[model samples]
Target: MTSKANRPCVQKLRCLLSVAVGILCAQSLAFRNVDSAAFDSFANLTAKGLDSIAQFGPAGSIALAACLGALFYRIYPNFKRVGKRNQLISVILSFFLALSIVVPRLMKLPNVSFNSFPNYVGGVPKWHKPIFWMVASIQLLTIGFTLAVIICWLMRKAADLVECRNTGEVSTAIPPTNLSIWERGVRFFDGKPMHMTVATLAMVLCWLPMLVIQGPAIIGVDSMVQLVQFRTGHVWDPMTMAELPGYVGQDHHPFFDTYLYGLFDELGLWLGQEVLGFRILIVLQSIVAALAIVVSLIWIKKRTNLPDSCICACWCLAAILPAFPMYMSIVLKDSTWVSIFLLWMVAFFEVIYRCNNNHAIGWRLVLCLVVLGLFSGLTKKLGIYVTTVSLLLAIIVIRKQFAAFLISMLVPAALVIGFVPMVVLPALDIAPGGPQETISVPIQQLSKVAILHQDELSKSDRQAIDRVLDIDHLKPYWQADSADYAKHYGYRLNASSSDRKNFILTWIRLFFRYPKDYIAAVPYLINPFVYGETYYYSGPVRCGWWEAGGSRILTEYPECGLSYTQGKIAIPLTNALNKTPPFSFIGSEALYTVWLPMLALGLTISIRRYRNLCYLIPTVVSWCSLFLLPAHQVRYTLSFLFVFALTIALPFAEVLTKERNISN
Candidate 1:
């Protein structure tokens, strides 16, 4: 039998989903498409102190209003106010009426603000009066409105079921409280796939405790560099006085990421007490990550009807997956990017198949694609290009999903092609500085070649090599095991374009003859991406790190502290965990999620169950993009791994479901 939902059921489900999404959107929409700094200013004031009462004073009233709104919708259907055909129309109208009231009231609700003490720290800029209130009003009102709409809808739905059971008629009355917690949960998740629900709850339970001991997991100097760059508008050289651009930092590290995290830092400033603000941010990150995991499982469960145990196993793996919580709590760009990319997969998974074969749902998913596609694309410099290429490849493979995927990418595709160059660059004064490939890939290979086959170099070749690097410097670097030969002792620091030309020619000449030499150096230079090896030339171990003078520098770096921050217990524990096996595998400089796409490729080729390569493609490309990067850090890929893991496993669960269906 086809899995498309029945008409009445589809409408009801859409209504319910819309309300749920609507409520979330209400609070979140204001934050969307707005300047990050405005929120930062709001958060800054909040950090100094917003009264606890002002923050949560409306809970009871808002809850009551929401319950009432749901009641209005529930009973309006029974009023006998309209004939059979109009019944659908009346119900729709009632939902809107309820929302109309709830939305306005919620928006008007009072929320805590920085009116009392606007400045968060000693010198950071404060929010302007108008922007501060605009942001706060949007957030506060949405909270109130969404709560009422959701509570009202939920209570009304429960009341309908209770009334249906007791009196053979649905009603608007409150639901009875005698049901067991399990039963209430069943009602709550009535139409949801059981496996999906289980997966969500499991992830929630797994990440809960980390909050109690949640310290900041500052991996290295990158986190500190970001924190410093945040205070300034642009990507600033932390070491340079007056924040002059550092030597080849953001270009190598991905400057767009600095922009994204800078916004988060602004939020941290807003939330109150730097440490506490960050913890809140971490908690928010965990929640969203869990939600993404849940959404991926739900989409999979819908497709496969996965067994409870298989779903449980998925959850178990997610729970133990070392990177999940570690990356979530850390103030890293990867964490946020991971969540966005995963959620984008939700639209991806939904579109490739069918959602009750509903066009409206498909359209909604496409709209989401445009927003998520653009946001995620713009977040990292290469993200848009990588994702665009992947989407094109996906269309070729999944011919059936071509229309949906094409429509989804149209807006973003346009912006990338036309807008980014003409508008974004000139407007933002974003200099076109990116991958210094002249140094990263070729130089590393040359260092390997020079070290392994010094005798092979002719006198002219030796002179040409010297133009790029002092061949003597290669010896000490080899002994020290420094992978970066391009920047050692200011190698290539002042080479003219002709010198660059000569070095490239020499690199290519040596590349063909001593290919094995290049092959030998590949292992460690790409160590972090290939496996979770944390041991490096910087030392087999150090607690904190950032790069400088072409080296990984270790230092204490929280950049900020808090009463409830997890820096002490969390940081040392994660670092210690990396030293061991099992967990050690998770420590790879590449994203742990990288394995999922690799696995998916293997399975998609062999097992028909694992065939949606769309989700896997971007991540695979992301992993490839790493080779182009100057450094090899796992944080670069950690944020993007979760979605694919869920997607790959879900297909297996469905394979079992398909087998069962065939047997039946």
Candidate 2:
């Protein structure tokens, strides 16, 4: 019989051989004194030797341990013990983890000068240096390996919960007969119209503190602008006697939202109390937002097999979360848009669910989608793009329901594309808001190039940029994270269509010619999404009652007789809530849901739960649009947070045999 490779003596000899090689490698690397050329002869040389030796021991130990760890890992590779589903999850998470590591670092990378086409002025430091590349690779691999192990362990626990859900092992429906008053009350409203009522009431109740403490409603500068427009028949900047341009009001602040605010202000005038009208408006707005949340929860409960506890938890979160109530109380377009967006998401999902299940397309659901779609587009300018793209995608995904989806968009599409621009806007004589808002991203890109690479810019590119923007003056207004100041401050109001066309052409050319600058420019855009908060107008909670430098609503419109007093106990209570647990995290823009959305998407895709994906389409489109924004405003993400809370329940369908597959 020949000696086997698995023999004990052979294994021992191999280990001994590995150790000997590792020590030799470490010594050779650490004790190389050739780079110590700075040392002078004799005395200096002796001192350098001591310093080198002192650094040698730790470096040698680390090198030897790394070699042994690599050998053991390659031989054992214990991660292979996980199931196929876990492996798939790990693969998905690995991509996300890599982005998490690379994107932030890439954002921080110094912009290297390009001396020639595709060649850097100074060769890339990380790539050119062997030590840097090797150390980075080793560190990334070590961290990734450790994280994968943790992921697998957590996934095992999740799989158990999923299994329990599938096997009907976990149920919250049954209530014992022996119960307290609160338990009895909960059981009583466990179903139907009462449940919806209770849910809506909970939200309204939570919002009351914001209303009572702040009084009437949280009136911001935008609210005053809307009031001035409706009251005076011309747009007026706060505190300034001068009127804005003749065409500035309609659809810029959105005439529909402004008109609603005006109606309430008129009611306040009729009642001799302007603030009373705002109070009524705030209460009704809260009701609408609360009802939308309830409707989505109701549909989710009926369609998915999510546990009662999860459903109830969602209801509580929407109702009790400090951020929701704060946003609800504010008088601005965002307050209205978020509610309409939530309702539209529910309608969108209803259509997809019916089509996928082969159920008949109901008239009620179609009408709801059409109506909600129109409101969504009308509430915000960006809504027009998001709604149109989403409906078009829905048509492509569920081709069999093409007629239903198309019909749903016809009215909203017509109003946004045809009626508003051609008839309504002109009839109202509102000047267009300009293209600056839509093209802020490109403007920011060009501004960066103008500031950093001015010397390298071609004459033609410079002329093209200068036609649309004040390229010579851009440096003073350019902000890394915001394009707002640059667009308004550096913008050329007289730039014609051709000028804009030239700028776009130049922007495209520069993007390809110097891609590193473009990449470097995007980190500011990614800060809020990847990390948590960015600069300006982003916070967990904001009471928009007043803004500095703006005329106070009470002072400017004193005839309307509004009061600015806060309840004696309001400040202390608000501060207490902000410092409290759960509420603090819930209200924190800093503690943004960085991982939740990623984890949800990964889990859903890994288990092939395609039906759940339909619920997330709007959020995906909305988030992608953020890259085009002038800056990262947290309020812009409010709709996403609302939809995500409900969609998170859908991934549990992975365990349900009946719901494993619903794709076309």
Tens-digit lDDT string for candidate 2 (1-664): 3288567775676566556544443332232232233123445544654554455456545665467444543332334555777776776675565344333322332432211111112222334445434433543454344445555654554556666766778546656775544444433234378777877887799768766655556665556667666665565433222345665464546778888888887898789876678778878888999888887777666566555566767777776665666667667788888889888887787676776676667778788888888888887877877877888877776676767778887778888767887888888876455666667888888888887888899999988888888966767766665787678677777788898998988999899988877766655566445422311121111122233322333443433233343334444445555433334435543223345556666666655566667656666677688778877667777776666556665565432345555431
Q: 1-664, model 1: which lDDT tens digit per residue?
A: 3256576775576467545544343233212212224345557534422232133234632453344445444543343432343333334433432332222212211221111111011112224557555644555454444433433343333334333434535233646676544334323222355745565666767876664555543333555554454454345433211233432224333456656555565665677444445566677778778877777655554554333345545556667665577567666666667777777766665554442222233566678888877767665545566657666777776665566678766677778656876676556544333223435566667766776677867988877777776657556654212345445442644466688788788877877798776655543344333332332111111132223221221123322332233545555655556543335434333324434444344333333333444446666666677666545455555545576445455334332222223211
Off by over 4 Å in 2: 1-84, 91-191, 234-248, 534-552, 556-585, 588-594, 653-664
Among the numbered candidates, top lDDT falls to 2
User: Would you give me the overall lDDT of model 2?
Assistant: 0.61
List per-prediction Cα lDDT, in the order shown.
Answer: 0.49, 0.61
Best by TM-score: 2
Candidate 2, pairs of clashing residues: 247-431
